[model samples]
Target: MTATASSPAIIRGATLQPRPWANGLGISHNIAQHGDGACGFGWMIATAELSGDAAFSHYPGIDRVFTIIEGQGATLTLEGSGPLRCRPFVPAGFPGDQATHCTMDGIPGRAFNLMLDRAGWRGSVTAQSLAAGHRMSLRATAIHCLAGQLAIGEDVLEAGDTMLPADNVTVAAQGAAAMALVVEVAARVG
Candidate 1:
């Protein structure tokens, strides 16, 4: 759908193309991004499927938020910090320039990621749970359904579906308990 100030662009999860990760140990599906070209993105949202233990790619002057969405979680070792346990559905934020490594708990899993250029933008990720018919208005950059189903106007979003609302949008759970990740981003003022 064409997005306007009062409309939202709905992206089906099944339509995303999988791309190889920079570290070569994983693949990722791009959901949305604010800029183009290599090293030019002000912010980005994607989901990753890791294959094995590996070091994360370094992005100087950027921040990253990672959340395990499926399977068991992993342990992240970041430079200058103690080991951090990345639990399912819980977001972990860190400096993208930090020396970091990931070791899977057992089987490799999928994770949702948000990366923002520190000098240009700021962002946040929040998990929301809604009961059937519960409605709420959200002023967010994007909303990603994690489980169950959500309805935004006439559009119904399934698990993995993402919606980029041009303005504040009201959404409700369809039939059962639903969970989603809400992302909000804004340009940083000097």
Candidate 2:
């Protein structure tokens, strides 16, 4: 679907299909992607559910951002780097080609994942909270609601729903408060 400045595209989390991880250790629900299938995507977004200790899939020439959304979180051990503590609402960035391992905190956890092709794209994720009636302008590529509800134009977004804006937009908190993850994607400059 084509999203215009006046109308953004919404992806409902419940409608996403689950796909097995490349390493076959976990499952992920693909949210959105861009680029040609023949050469692979320039960027992709998804939510992953990890149940136990496991190694991450390697994606050469790509960068990744993983944010814990539910549960107690996990520890990520990336090759050539110190162990990363992944807690709820915190996003961690790393090279997708790096050998990485994840150790969960006993129970299963869910995370939002972003992958970008290093040669052409760069991206970042930021968590934000908006008070009731508060509005925030978005220059972001996408925004995922983590809690509460948000109103963007005539559309209302609930937790787990994601919106891709074609241009800068503003979102307002619907109730008491709302939490979201704003994602920004841009072409890599040489």
Candidate 3:
């Protein structure tokens, strides 16, 4: 299904807290999730802080992408695949059904995670910094503010806020240090 254009949803950093993960070794703050059904959702975004090494929960028929937000990052060991290095700001994608294991590299860190139910949708996430006078096309379905301030016309977004921009809307950054994570979602193909 084609996505309908809508105003972005904004989440404030100060009004949130970390909830326990399924594994109980970490905590996460849900940023947003879109989809409706009795049993499942199409996509979800969250911020998590890992306090120790642990096994990740497995979700069949889903895809997960993660990016480090703070600290020294971690390593992911997929059940059947080689280990993956998760560094700061670099997004990594993997199957959610895999028996994933986590190992803290140095210091505990926070990460941004995007999960898509593969039976209905697929998506990607990337980090970017926009400065004043820099024009950017809001091609992604959602944008999450990571740091600093950004203005889309009269709408302003600060850290921890998420928004859905109109397709092809070109806007310039209002300040320096405006960084964000862009999430693009699409229907799954056969």
Top candidate when judged by lDDT against the true structure: 2
lDDT of 1 by residue, 31-142 (tens): 9888532357889999998777888888778899999998799999999999989998899998988999998898988999999988888889989999988999999999
lDDT of 1: 0.89
What does candidate 3's lDDT look like per residue over 131-173, in tens digits? 7658687787777888887676566878887666656555556
Clashing pairs in 1: none
Lowest summed-lDDT stretch of 10 residues in model 1?
32-41
TM-scores for all predictions: 0.93, 0.94, 0.87
lDDT of 2 at 11: 98
* Winner on lDDT (2 vs 3): 2
Model 1 TM-score is 0.93
lDDT of 3 at 80: 82
190: Cα error in model 3, Å: 3.6
Tens digit per residue, CA lDDT, model 2, 10-62: 99978989999988888999999886322288889999988788999988888
Superior by lDDT: candidate 1 or candidate 3: 1
The runs of at least 3 residues in candidate 1 whose Cα sits more than 4 Å from the true structure, single-residue gaps closed, are: 36-38
> Model 3 Cα RMSD, Å?
2.7
List the lowest-lDDT window of 10 residues for candidate 2: 34-43
